[model samples]
Target: MEESPAAARWRVPPAQTALKCAAAAVFAVLAALSDEPGGLLLAAVATLGSGGLALRDLLAPVRVAADPGAVTVVTGFAGHRTLTWPEVLDVGTDERRRFLSTTRLLEIRTDDDLYLFSAFDLGADVREVADELDRLRAGGPRS
Candidate 1:
């Protein structure tokens, strides 16, 4: 069967989400407790900034795809980066405990430059995606 264009993603880790929730809660309390307007303003800024980062992360996993010839990372831009089989030279395990099954990192050395893909920023299904990318790149995807 032909592959669908929709990018598949592993969901974000619960630990990360919990941490973000905690930070937001703390920041909210700080903002509320502040007696001076400046303190409140700072707290609000921190809360908003942190929330923005979290939102960016939530959206990133939805923008990636792996195929036999290449692993395409969609940047939601006019142009996207593609890592060919040959470009993907090695995989790295970051030894970080953030997600469930994704690799720590994937190191790619293309004809032109080197690229590193880290799953620490991804959700739950990264391991499956990585394995699929490896298989497809090695042996073309099943028809």
Candidate 2:
């Protein structure tokens, strides 16, 4: 189906998805090559974990989508939660500092929940996403 011109979508980048898949493959190979039962178990667990994550990303790549009516966000594996524009109390950015590094996140606040999406999660700059969301919310031109 074709999305409306007012809609915006974001997802995990293909490169990151490929990296997860690659990690899963490497773990699978390790599992096949391991001689010790403990090593085999570890590799098997890693393989399953990474493989599941990769599959999830591949199947449900769109992490966030917003349109004139509402905003939908992936809440779990193949699951989504949508909040109408009226339910959205605020859209902004937050900074997280850990030691020498700082991470920016897009935050959406609703009546009962606060959703945060990182740049990696949205596959775009947090600031840019925030600006777009603001414009969309304000019924301004997307450009």
Candidate 3:
């Protein structure tokens, strides 16, 4: 049987998380090994601190199986943002970051709310994923 599109909604790619953890470990070691070493203990601390945040953000996505009635962006996560999709009204990119730089923003509108989501907090597949979100809000398939 085919899985429903709702069952295939966006979630962070698992390998991404593992890879981040591994990269952090590698960096901690390399940093600690440098001529001007960050110090083994300091590197370890840094790795743990950042790894925790990465893991948290990696798991912060709660809409992997279906789009909400509307999108809601809760920016005050103790560490990460929480997003609900059905309320999102528009998404756009701005070159304000620099002459060649752009930022993605998701503008949401609800019966009594408005908010925006930025690309800065997102990862590699941002364009494709954000496009899907756009289609979803427009009442269409992820295509």
**Top candidate when judged by TM-score against the true structure:** 2
Native-referenced Cα lDDT, model 3: 0.51
- The alpha-carbon deviation from the true structure for residue 41 of candidate 3, after best TM-score superposition, in angstroms, is 5.9
- Estimate the overall C-alpha local distance difference test score of candidate 2: 0.88
Q: Per-residue CA lDDT of candidate 3, range 1-143, in tens?
A: 01256433444456666777787888677666866534766777778876875666565643222253444343444233334554444554332465776665544455465444444344334455456556655667554
Clashing pairs in 2: none
Q: For candidate 1, lDDT tens digit of each residue in 37-140?
A: 99999998888776665665555434345655566654432235776667666533333565675335544455666544555444533444466555666764
Better of 2 and 3 by lDDT: 2
| Residue range 1-143, candidate 2, lDDT tens digits | 11468888988888989999999999999999999999999999999999998998998888889987888988768788989899999999999899999999999999898988888888899899888888778888867
Which candidate should be chosen as best, given lDDT against the real structure?
2
RMSD of 3: 5.4
Give lDDT: candidate 2, residue 68: 74
Q: What is the C-alpha lDDT of each candidate?
A: 0.57, 0.88, 0.51
- In order of listing, the candidates' clash counts read 3, 0, 8
